[model samples]
Target: MTVSKKRTISDESRVFQEKWSHNYFFIQVKEKAICLICQESIAVMKEYNLKRHYSTKHAAKYDMIEEKLRIDKLALLMKNIQGLYLSLKTGHKDSEASIKASYIIAQKIVAKSKPFTDGEFIKECMEVSFEILCPAQKQIFSKLSLSGVTIARRIEELGTNIESTLKERISKFIFYSLALDESTDLSDTIQLAIFVRGVDSNFNITEELAALFPMKGTTKSCNIFNALKSTFNRFDIKLNNLSGVITDRAPSMIGKNEGLIALIKKEMGTCGALQLIQYHCIIHQENLCGKSVGFQTIMKDVVKIVNFVRSRALNHREFKNFRSEIDAEQGDLIYFTDVR
Candidate 1:
């Protein structure tokens, strides 16, 4: 029998040069190449085995490293883009403007009596109205504090702004007349309403409701005067600018000795103004005159009949329906009050 000889490759004849061979560490021992990365031996000592090892084992690591670098670079680019957008939109590189913008938006919301937590409002603005807002504006809204307390503070700020504006405008007026009236609301709380009519430097009329002072305790003439004085002092309203005072025929309002009008006149006299014209409300005078007419008996009968028709629920509904069916111009009788 003939014996077979084993084939062995020599290092001198082995082809180690390959494109992938440079990427891996190799060791040659006994004419066999060993791949350091995979810790495996190459028996035949050819480029194919090394290339196959690299493609199969270490190719995923290369791909992963490349993907990670790409993702990191992309993330950095996006960050720079966001920073550029913010710089372009807000006109500032800071978040301070967001606070002022939020307050302004809150002021409008409060002025319009909108619900403070209406997230749908912002959503609608983002989607429809303010969809063209720049990235900075979007970022501002995202970082804003729009809680209920924040809204409430904004409302107070709005009121302060309004008061400041009113004070400025009122200061431009040379003379102003105060129309004051006291009345009780449905809750039986006594309220003193004061309005001012003034002419500006341009001779334009400016009429404003000055105050709605609540009278908690005794509403005597002294208390009324004190309240008016406090309001005037708070607003820096000058007594020298007082031109006229008008009020209803209430004793506490117009009494010569201790009335609010008399006290104001006394203060004006001390300030050296000759006279502050006083006038009773024309409506009150007309109402007083109407009461003196000789139609009291007829008024009583009319009131009784009107009450019979309007006081009962069924009668009131039937009367209303009849009036509608007949196309009556005056559907219900006019309500009258006994002032006396």
Candidate 2:
């Protein structure tokens, strides 16, 4: 047999042959090559695996551009957050300080981030800004923490002390007129205020607040008498020097047999008793007679129109513009006054 010259295998051919043989052996042995990206692999190369590998290991050049874009977007978001935070802090500085500080810190966080672009990010910043700007809710919590009964008792004690001090000073006046009135607050709490009218050294009517008390009931004459007597005793006021009592013509005050006037007269034996005088309050009489009917009606009508206009979006804008114009012309508008 002619010995054929041994054919030399090229380096690439040899390497290919070795790789093919290794792959064949691995398949026969049921072994697999692990993908670096996903950590699992099939016998054949997967497109997703290949892409992942390229992205993780060979994408350094493209990553620089992506990172720069991300940083710029983040910076923009941060700037917006900073602006919102500053606005909120400035708005609430008068109402709450601690809340403003927290908002400022949050704003700094957003500002420090690289620029970014995402509607969600902007929306989140806006939400946080609104939360910071909301009125302080902690005030209600603080008020709720106070003891209601204790607060009421303290107020009563203060009123009593004030009444006592006023009485002591008033004892110097030889003659004084006691004016009693009942009024109701917004909460409908009945309050009785006493006023003292006497001539001072300068011969001027020196009117002063003498006492104030919460009335038990509107129609209870006995309660009123007892309250008045207790107040007098508390202030060490002698019934002998009590000059005259001026009050409205209310049934509880001036009723014939069971009223405060009758009780005081019985106690002082009629001669040393308090002189009862009926005086109608001018303000109360005016209110009852509807004296400012036209003025009040006009004011109410104007307010209603203004409110109606403000309720609509377009009208509100128009109203604001009109208000600015009116303010500009206000200096030229002369207010007429009657000097009679």
Candidate 3:
């Protein structure tokens, strides 16, 4: 009977040689041989294994280089690896530019009342345009993150920045007037929008959207007052600096008792030297006047014409098709909102 002998390989033979880097473009990494070009790892440091990997994978191109040309090729590969690392270091700078671009696009999207998901589609169209117009810019556009989530975050950031800047401007105001309006959105939520017109000590006048509060419940006079107070507190606005309040003829806005204007006056007290001026919104008055009996005669005819095209499904579709045939910018007549 004879005992079978098992072959054993020592750690020294497993150690990678320095020459392998120049010979087969493989480097010693944690005791394993790693290919420079493909980054594939060789388990054993045997020359035959490295040679087989190089010959089968990269030898067709790299093997053609000899002497100084081989050395230069090796140097170029090393430089490429270094370049990859350097790109990561400069990625932060590129990210700032990308963020600015994203905010500009987000502003336009918000202004146009576009859904957040449109950002992705816009990016795809922009990339295609870039590919056709300037292929060199494709890499730059690829860096932008215009996904819906990213766009939402970017818009939120822009809003916060604007709010902060507006607050800073408000703090410097010598006098300011507020214009308030309330409307229900498609979701039936009451939205209260407030605008501020302010003049600083330097007489620099600034007008901006001060607040847009959502009233989940009833939008009563007291509720409107509370919302205004919250906005004032948030912006650190002083009550005495208020010059005027502007609003439509809504009872909740201009009521004598417990109205938003009355509530503000009550807070300011009766003994103030300068009286708080109340201004009815001229635009709102004009809109109300436009619906008066005198204007109704003309508007009725306009409404009839609009309804002729919009009242029926077939009429609407045919009108749209006709408009398209004529290359009309407006697809159909706009139905009058307050027409009776």
In TM-score terms, which candidate is top?
A: 3
Count of residue pairs whose backbone atoms collide, per candidate: 0, 11, 0
On lDDT, the leading prediction is 3
Q: Mark the 10 consecutive residues where model 2 has the least summed lDDT.
A: 20-29
lDDT of 1 by residue, 1-340 (tens): 9998766565247666543334444546466776655547888777777767768887676545445574564445445655655777765534576577668778778768888775336644664534475653464455566667777787788878877877887888888899988889888888999888888889978887778999888889999998898778767898888899999988999897988888988888888875799988988888888888757877899889888887788998888899999999987765678888
lDDT (C-alpha, whole model) for all candidates: 0.75, 0.55, 0.87
**Candidate 3 C-alpha lDDT tens digits along 15-88:** 67778878898877677877889878888779999999999989998888889888888888877866775898
Off by over 4 Å in 2: 1-164, 185-188, 199-206, 265-275, 291-340
lDDT comparison, 1 vs 2, better candidate: 1
Give the CA lDDT, 0 to 100, for residue 54 in model 1.
66
lDDT of 3 at 48: 96
| Tens-digit lDDT track of model 2 for 1-340 | 8987775434223211223212221111124333322233444333344446546663564345445574564445445655665877765663465433333433443356522223235434545665677635433222221133333443455556666667666666556666777888787888888777764355555577766778756647787777777766766656665667777767888888987777776776755745544455666677766875756666677767766775678877776677688786532212233359
User: Would you list the rank order by TM-score, best first?
Assistant: 3, 1, 2
Candidate 3 residue runs with Cα over 4 Å from true position:
1-93, 270-273, 296-340
